[model samples]
Target: MSRQKTESEVARTTGRLGPAERADNWRRLGSEEFDVVVIGGGVTGAGTALDAATRGLRVALVEARDLASGTSSRSSKLFHGGLRYLEQLEFSLVREALRERELMLTRLAPHLVKPVSFLYPLTHRFWERPYTAAGLFLYDTMGGARSVPGQKHLSRAGALRMVPALKRNALIGGIRYYDAQADDARHTMTVARTAARYGAVVMNSSQVTGFLREADRIAGVRVRDVETGEETEVRAQAVINATGVWTDELQRLSGGRGRFRVRASKGVHIVVPRDRIVAESGMILRTEKSVLFVIPWGNHWIVGTTDTDWNLDLAHPAATKADIDYILEHVNTVLATPLKHDDIEGVYAGLRPLLAGESEETSKLSREHAVARVAPGLVAIAGGKYTTYRVMAADAVDAISGDVAGRMAPSITDRVPLLGADGYHALVNQADQLAAEHGLHPYRIRHLLDRYGSEIHDVLALGDERPELLKPIPAAPNYLQAEVAYACSHEGALHLEDVLTRRTRISIEYAHRGIDCAEPVARLMAEVLGWDDARVAREIEVYTQRVDAERDSQLQPDDQAADAKRSAAPEAREKLTEPIS
Candidate 1:
């Protein structure tokens, strides 16, 4: 049969690179010009690239490390309306976040983001119930709350029944509110990928070493490929600086005087087995300074978040015993069965790039983000929550449109579903059939669908070629062989840390820190990546040392001591000594 060519074919033939065509197109980067160059591979930068590309502007995104290597992947993993922001009377922030939440859950990355219920336990009976109810009532109506159900009030007895792990005396009642959650790393990567799908040049581990200046205006950047140690000069009419915590450093690189300084506030989270906390839903507890969340991940409960001023290392913020104790102390007061040191399976620390303010209270700092036109051709955006990244992205692209020569359209990301969102529903309906045809269990098919959505077909195809790839991983029985291969091929997972920490979440989900599974997983990855036995062994050893370093640091008394101990681990990337031959 003869194929009919349409306008879409015309568009494709007009020489545009889709997501699947990015690596090849990125090869032609230094040889051509870009309309807009984006710095930082965090949520905002990736979104900006997507926004600019979808608006029919030529775009390029460069990252110093892998995508979401910064604060984007280390977030609370919630797509919320900033319930705490409401207390601060930041109604606009809350509304904007909620609107973004609705977009993600409904039209955007539906598969990536899903609704989660949180139990806000009431410590005061009469005053709190009505007081909270009024606020929640208003919360329900604002910023398109249709994506999640409205808050439901529960009595003291009812609250205890829902969260049996909580102390019976801790709450007088409770209110259950709904918010969406997502795999932050996966979503950020998908955003970058989707942007590439719409004709953006997305490349990872490519650092913008220096800014290319044309007199007073910023023209482009000098990019160094971290993997190959190759340098390229990428020219663009406009450059967007979306480096979250490193905004000042990027500004300095661009020779632009930053209008504001971004201060890093360290937040630490501990992950423990879910069985230790027997609860029907997640809990939201108020601490002395800030709020704490007991979020439910797949096989574990994530209890956290100590907010303190951090002047230490930014790359890997170490969690001390004191930080863990602070979280455990406060949460233990509310829990019927207290958590111990041995109960924790994982500990992670991330810095919040709060817009610097005069206030001493880090918690009191604004969650509201800002975008600035730093130089003649440079746009910088910082200090935004993950939920409002799209807004930040839209604002960023808008800031640079005047500088872009060609006509640039407004951001239409609100209507744009992410890479795997379009056919997710149909894939869910077809899971059973897919499982039957593939000779795999229906449960496995469901797991793949939840993680990859419609992209499950791509994963299945990997195993389809080699039936051995369908079998379960040796130690980590939950993951399949094909997943390890898929992570490397499709997801751009270069290191073992990328696979364990972000891609599959084995770092936190497993009790042994993936020690037992590391070798097997590394071997599987080696087969796909063509890594020799020595290289595979080296990867495993490095990962093991990192796990050991983190464990040793967590057992330390103070942050300084813990950070010093964790810093003893090897560097994330090698220093540039010998250039690529």
Candidate 2:
């Protein structure tokens, strides 16, 4: 049985991904024949790396940019089984997702994934309540409820009491059911860190430039450092592509026909202050096209999302005026005080890699993932929700297990816990003691514990010699000054955008959209990244332009105009162009 971690053990847990790890991994990539080389640093790729490493396999994961800087981070942040998928009779998919959700909540990521309640309003009079109750009953009992509470039926008045923001006539009644949520970016980062802990060489800002061909079969990959422009050939027994929306694009780079195609469906979200919603639980409403979720985030409510076809730039999906207005108008239909443009604090858009099918509606596309060997030594996985990333990763690795080495172990991620998960519950009980020791508020210490778990001490150690690092940031007061430095020194943050956008939610959590604290954050990051005055100024300029471009894109009436405006901003690095098919 496992026991609580000692201070020395916690200190040496060493998922510390500083500049040294990057440099060392970069050197080691070319020197060894890795058992498996996983592409993409998103949740699936990271999870795959973790699974492979934990099974005594030599693994290396490469990302062209920062971890979860793509669809992974921009998801709805839910660990819930798809309630809507039940309507389509996708029982196996729902059951699989629910099982994974239970694992995340109770065993794997107790510190990160927490149970959240959602109010499903009944708009229709008679059969709606019974029908929804039946569905929620299945949802609650599908896999098992070892963590979150089951569904509870409530009257309209009771529902309004749960969510005071709902209008009087918004519903006849409602059923509040439990689901889990997490900071997708943080979860993905922790997965990468856990992989590192298990001896996986995980590095971001390393892009695969081309595939290495061994005559009639596949061999390895040639990759380039997006930071230093250094090229290296990493010989691996097999490679798994978990590039999400870029799945089709990466398949093209291999010069082969993938088993299937992936279609990009753009989903946009707007952030409003929590006080604006005045809700005890999140709200889920049905829209003509899809569904809208007014999710409860800390100190803010996240309203989203618009599902539509996107044919433009996949890297930076833009939220158009139509998308924003659509979300607002739909969510406003039941609001006690309808949200306005002024209430909007931030906006973001992400592309979902839905499996291309006969269904014209992107919302109807299957979230059930598919894995196939596009060529010898190459496996491609795509089309799954963020909640089921582990299953997807396990499947992807299993596809190549036979070819890579002899008698590989079966997927054991079901029993594996992420870094900081082991000692998390104990630390939560010691929040007050931790606060006193660290000279922080109990609430603040608790917050840090949730974010870092047992790794809180490691982060707190950084401020031991520098007291000023413990203070909160001026512009975005929710985050501390040390987080900026820590993002670089320990989180593989290479640019200012990496820190603001994904490392933290500041970019989309505030009205200023991290503009006020951009310079201070840049300065803090510069201290760790060794950015000169010129580089700092340039970093600030690029981030500011990106924000401006997003703002400009949101004013446009349609997708084409918005895409053009969003694409006008320069990329931080020269991303590899998709090879001609």
Which candidate ranks first by TM-score, i.e. highest? 2
- Please list the C-alpha lDDT of all candidates, in the order they appear: 0.83, 0.88
Tens-digit per-residue lDDT, 78-106, candidate 2: 89889899999999999999999999988
Candidate 2 whole-model C-alpha lDDT, 0 to 1: 0.88
Candidate 1 residue 141 C-alpha distance from true site, Å:
1.4
Could you estimate the TM-score for every candidate? Answer: 0.94, 0.96
Q: Which stretches of candidate 1 lie over 4 Å from their true place?
A: 1-26, 143-145, 576-581
Predicted model with the maximum lDDT: 2
Cα deviation of 68 in candidate 2 (Å)? 0.5
